[model samples]
Target: MSRHLRLALVQASAQSFEDFAQGLRSLMKSPNAAELVIYPELHLCSLGAETMSEREYYTAYAEPLDGPRGMALAGLARELGIWLIPGTVLERGADGAVHNTAVVYNPQGELVADYRKIFTWRPYEPMCPGRRFVVFDMPGTGRVGLSICYDAWYPEVTRHLAWMGAELVVNLVQTSTSGRAQEIPLNQANAIVNQIWVASVNGAAPTAQGHSLLVDPEGGIRVAAGMEDTTLLGVIDFDRVAATRKFGTSGDSWPWDQFRADDSPLELPLYNGHIDPATWRPAISPETRNDLRPAGPVVFCRPAGENGPQ
Candidate 1:
């Protein structure tokens, strides 16, 4: 049987945490409010300075997983009778390292998943990386996966969730004002290749791009919001995911049922079936290919024992 989820993406433009909270309360009262509500990334960081460097900003605002901010969000979930993904906040771990963490709350207001983001856009982000990937089943919704902002650039994250049976991948983002071109396309491509619905919510201007979007399994833009302060709502159909994977006769499929017995678990059937095992060798080279030329001017480093560059 196919499943459907009604979702709302709140594209925020609030300049302060208090303003964000106030606006959120009003949005919930909309006649179109959905069963699942999601907000853009780092909405809580509004209380801090916009001029602060990434390091300064994150460190100052970091809070514990069950801190006041989290409690407030969880309470809202229960009060509204909705499953909530209130985007991410800075989590100050027991070891004192700050992580970009997203928390999931079921309708009962129980924390279902506390996912610290696995990939931080480093050299620029200055946040600690997470070690775990989180996927959980919602009561009426199919399995749900969580990722935040930069994590959407890495297909492996989404693929891991899909493999774990997630029909929907939710990415809460604070898009770079200068990088929206790349950000939008990468997420759309990820949804197409993985054949899963993606709810990509983004922070609003005058600091970040606010093109919060909902993508269907076929990579269609079901709903998209401009760089404005508004909520975008859409319905996600799990039936589309099932339809995408259906292939061949006897109910065999592309992804959901592709990892059949007698197939090499590590390799997809498309590639494994085309190769002759007896004659195969690893296709990868042990070292970088000498034929490839560096795109920029190169500087040569000599071996310790050698007098000149090799």
Candidate 2:
């Protein structure tokens, strides 16, 4: 059995919900319809953000995960009969705090997984930060991890997702600054270090500095788009991720296979923590980590200290 996924990265400028929906419908009707369609971060929420104050913007758009916008996005996915990731939204949590969240809708119109942006862009981005990491399996395709714009700056974000058995990590971005140049390399570096596929989608001109790209398991750029409104399409083979890990990157470096279960822990003063070799292995094998399987619901990862005392 071959595990393959057809991906569509929509690198377009921010738009109103009406325009966004229309564009999505047109994309689905195209000859090259993709299995999974992804847009850049806040693509739908940026419509009137420029006119409103920061607080006003968040307050006006923030809604629950199952809110109207979410339901509409679900309907779009179901109607199109494809997996859809319409970028990040402003979520109004039960605790009343607003968060920048990314949602996933399966082909059945089910909202399978939602991940909030863990690394909010500080003072500029006023939304509350999310504490958990998220990954969801795509039945026959493969496992996918979610990350937002600023999260790519932190290597641990991708590292944790890779450890959780994610074959591909999608980082949704809406960058308009010159910093996009730096982000491009970060995308490739994340794929290289984790030996996994990476798809970083950025918004197009006017809304962002679009340089959306897809990096292969070996850190090679498979497809990249310029700063324009365009859709990048590619066929991703999940088996390549497994092969890369097994055979080594470029057939030389094998970071994941180098450690032994009995190896001593390597301490790190940064987080006052140590990498325990016993549990440092990738959680890809079903026989080893059944909880990671796609049979159940979405997986929410709480890092070391979140659950309780370490």
Write down the lDDT of every candidate, Cα atoms only. Answer: 0.70, 0.86
lDDT of 1: 0.70
Candidate 2 lDDT over residue span 144-256, tens digit each: 89999999999999998888878899999999999999999999999999989999999999779999999999999999999999999988988888777666799899887
Model 2 reaches what TM-score against the true structure?
0.92
* Residue lDDT tens for model 1, 159-270: 7666555668899898756777677777787787777788899987776788888887767888998887788889887656655644312234243333333454354475
